[model samples]
Target chain A: MSTPVLDVQGLAFAYPDGHQALYGVNLHVHRGERVALLGPNGAGKTTLVLHLNGILDAGAGSVAVSGLPVTKDNLREIRRRVGIVFQDPDDQLFMPTVRDDVAFGPANLGIRGGELEKRVMEALDKVGMADYADRPPHHLSFGQRRRVAVATVLVMEPEILVLDEPSSNLDPASRRELAEILTGLDVTLLMVTHDLPYAFELCPRSVVLSDGVVVADGPTYDVLTDDALMAAHRLELPFGFDPRAIGRR
Target chain B: MGQGHGHKLHFHGHSPVHRAAPHHKLLALLGFTLVVVATPKDWFAAYGLYLLLLAAVVVVSTVPPTYLLKRLVVEVPFVVFALLMPFIATGPRVEVLGVSLSEHGLLAGWALLAKGTLGVLASLTLAATTEPRDLLLGLERLRLPQQLVQIMGFMIRYVDVVGDEMRRMRIARESRGFTARNPKHWPVVARSAGALFIRSYERGERVHLAMVSRGYTGSLRQGSDR
Candidate 1:
């Protein structure tokens, strides 16, 4: 098989206060694959996502994006390859205008002038926010702001698009709209979400993290259908929403 | 979600003043205020001319006089100070309408009111015409320190976020039947304030991490190459 776009091997980390967030964890995502990282609260989902982009250094093991290790020296290139869209769009869209926010990542790489404008517009266009390039992020609807947040990372053209709780705050229409957009994208996806239905619809495979360890890794259908496994990990589907009834996309 | 309008101070218009470059307007505001401040307090005619000039600019800018007047309530404290100047200041005495007054004090008071009013009016005009984003760009063009500029940039971007968070906190408090109507409730308010500060600090840390994830090294590279 071709090299996995994202490779995490035995990755572990503890906070400065000695709260161990992640134990030894191993995962691999190949090119153009969508994998959901499912876990309950404090299961080290955010800790693992932070490690993927060097925001948090690993205590042991390694994380590599397309064969490039995430390190101080390779941070710039690594960040370019691994784009993490935070759960709250407010945290990500910090620039004064949508155009500036979208251009921020590429501009940091020294992209300028017409090239920067083109990249910004293209990303906005992809998210159907082309008309809002000049709007302040605060003026946007919550869902629009979320889409703009996605564009901010997309402008960088990352190899692996890491989304942290992409559907947390969206209404049903916005959720469906975002799902459509995500399904159409070509990049590798690593989504950390508790939205079981979202995981079923978007990601074919799922990894269940419990007590900072990967307890289950298999098809989304298999993971969601395992009643005992779901019960043990506190991973519950919305009441009466059956994965078998909906089936795989 | 309803708070999507641009800055409240800004009035949308296509007047020539609005079309003028922000840096140019900033410099003009500075020049006008300095000239007003430097003029002798006794030069009542010069002050009137300055007012006329400002009034003309206001007319050109197309911002309503009532809009400017309503916001001028911010100047009430200064007005009180100016009004008290004549009564408290020691100077040569004079009688006007059978009331004792100091001649120099009257002039000083007049000067204070005139200068303060002119400065406030001019600033309002500038703010009413230029968008907040453009004002930041104008400051950048004026060679303001990049760090300060970035601070203001972040403040503009996150002010709404902080405000929304505060609103939610207030709603949560109200839902729990908490209200600070007197000094007895001070501690609750203070604790809420403390919580907000900590939350904002944590948010700052998260924002920094987000910046780092996007390749922000130390200083922002925006406008450096442009």
Candidate 2:
């Protein structure tokens, strides 16, 4: 695999109120590898994701996206290389119009003129939202709005796309569409999700977190099949539904 | 989830007024109001002509006359104020229907009505023709502060979401044995409002974090898919 695009070492973070979220988490993502971070609530999945993109400052240790360290000075460059999608589509899709929301990141990055406009269209097209450019965010369905949120980040064309619960609230069709879209993208992905089937489908590697620590990381099939570890972390497969059999072609 | 996206109640149609640029519409509307406001008490002819101009615009735009009049009823609460104006002032008596009333007061009431109607029509036409996004853009072009525009843009985008959330909260409270009949339940209503505010604040923080991950700096911009 290409040299690790994202490098992290012993990352830790605590809210000012003293609630520790991430506990010395050590993880890395290589180019073109789709990795899933699976854990129950309060597992610090979002906190770790925020650190990857430098959204929140780490209390300890280090994080680097595409070799750029997450810091005040390198934040802009790090952000450009790592696009993170929040769990809630409502939170992400905040512009008056879909076109505006998608163009927001690119425009902020200083892209302008015909080139900027082209990027905006291409980004919307990436998420199958070309026809929704004129529609306001509030006017779209939940599934459609979720796709627009993805487009908003895709416009940046980051090297590593980090998603917090991409499939969380989506319906079956939307979930399938999300899987299809994520699978087709040729970039590094570190998605934080609790859906075992979704993780098995999109990612070949699975990383388990519990109490803010990475307890297990390995091939998706092997890690998911470990029932003892899954039980400890509250991860489970639905009745009679198997991940390995359904995940692969 | 309004599948029937009752697409905001704007008076939209293919009329000269509707087709005009939002910038021009805003200017014309504001100027018309300013003229009415600045007019002398006896300047009813100018005010009448301006009202006529507004009516002509309304006809040019295909917005339902009833809808236009209905929206104009926001001034209903001011009826008492208007009624008292003529009698409160000391001026030449203008008694027609066997009642003493100030002529100045009558002129003032007419001027207020004419100006208010004209202003509302101008805004209605602008809103009917141009979407909110376009209106914000027009404002930006007019050199309104960027911060103000950004705030307004987000407000417009999320108002419906927040409104829906509020509605759901009310429903939830009602389902749990709360009702408007109890005077003692006022605190519960206030608490819900406070809770809603907290939820909104947290939601804003999460949303901001999401934006930063997607490469947002402080600047806000929209795509040109159109």
Candidate 3:
């Protein structure tokens, strides 16, 4: 009903070597909606996500965040609105300490002094990483690093929190904790993942991309249960993950 | 990633030296080193004074004496070089214990050993008191080249990541019965190094894109997140 927070239309892209990564892909994410962009490796999921914040320009079409067209002129604004949590927490939390990593985005945007400190603390607190603020990121466990990565983006106060393969390397407990943190946030979410169970658990809507195009789009449970569609896209749920039996937590 | 924080020289504590601003301590250390270097070699008492000054700092900082001794291992090569000087130089000879040695050589070696040891100890003390990140920040504040500082920052941040990758590769190699005990096994090590380089490069690209997405427009602003 509300204006979409993210709008991508006919987006197509190809690397310089002529490998087409995305082909006329279209997607829309409404305000506060959590959508999982599910696909196999090299299925252009990352390329599509890159296009969301203008990191990779649309080769043929357009991507607009909060109705602002993603272009050189609007890039700063668009980036401010779309916070991307990269796949590697090491990459995302490049700053020395957890607090600095959390403050990096907002500080780059010129937030300073008490307000900057407050944002850093609040972001760390949101991820339950306040106690680790002063610690070097390398000192933390992998799961802790991932949580700090999430806080790094959260400090920017972006409308849409885009996560890349968030559940890939986490232990079960960390995975559950991360899910709880993510679900508690009141923002639009676009998670790119190959983790079928993670997609089903976190996102109500799912868009399946295959060979650079959307092959399926609907409720996650429905898309996941469609065996032929899942097979066609090379999506496989774990042997015991039956979508029909698990109620939304 | 599996290892400890792993900064061997840095001993974390809340002593006055540890609490001092990094740039201030960096400046102080530089000034002290200059004073030591400028002191004439014949001024043995001045050297003793310098040693006493350093000892005072060490005592005040509460850095364990044994810790400093452990860190001194890094200066072993220099010590060896200095030791060679007393035997190798050609000059007027002197006999102390019936072994003839050059008087100039002896003085030169003494000066080198004293100055070098003092300098290394001062450095170790500075390192012990300051966090590595703060040291980088101190360098940036002291007008070190921005590009060099950025490179250093990236190296400090990702050294562990690269180390972890290498560990994984090594495990993967060893699990497959690749025992690198001889020269013939070097090719495998070299290949793994090459692979690590390529992986690191790709990861660099990904990190850059991640930075771009979060509005990193070239220059990095020092965050007041402390």
How does chain B score by TM in each prediction?
0.89, 0.84, 0.87
Per-residue alpha-carbon lDDT of model 1 for A1-249, expressed as tens digits? 988899999999989999999899999999999999999998999999999999889999999999999888999999999999999888888887788889889988889888988998999989999999888888898999999999999999999999999999899999999999999898899999999999999999999999999999999999999999999999999988998898766
The sequence of per-residue lDDT tens digits that candidate 3 reaches over residues B47-121 is: 999999999999999999889988888889988988887789997899979988888888988998999999999
User: Ranking under lDDT, best-scoring first?
Assistant: 1, 3, 2
**Candidate 1 structure quality by residue, lDDT tens digits, B1-226:** 5474777789999999999998999999999999999998888899889989989988998899999999988899989988887788886889889988888778888899999999999999999999877888888889989899788888988887898888888899989999889999999989999999999999998888898899997666333333
RMSD (CA, angstroms), candidate 1: 1.9
lDDT of 1 at A145: 92
Error of 2 at A219 (Å): 1.6
Question: Which of the CAPRI classes, incorrect, acceptable, medium or high, describes model 1?
Answer: medium
The residue ranges of model 2 lying beyond 4 angstroms of the native Cα positions read A244-249, B3-7, B84-111, B181-184, B221-226
Q: Best by DockQ, which number?
A: 1
Model 2, span B191-217: residue lDDT tens: 889999999999888888777766666
Error of 3 at A135 (Å): 2.2
DockQ, prediction 2: 0.58
Chain A TM-score by candidate, in order: 0.98, 0.96, 0.97
Index of the highest-TM-score prediction: 1
lDDT (C-alpha) at residue A58 in model 1: 98
What docking class should model 3 receive? medium
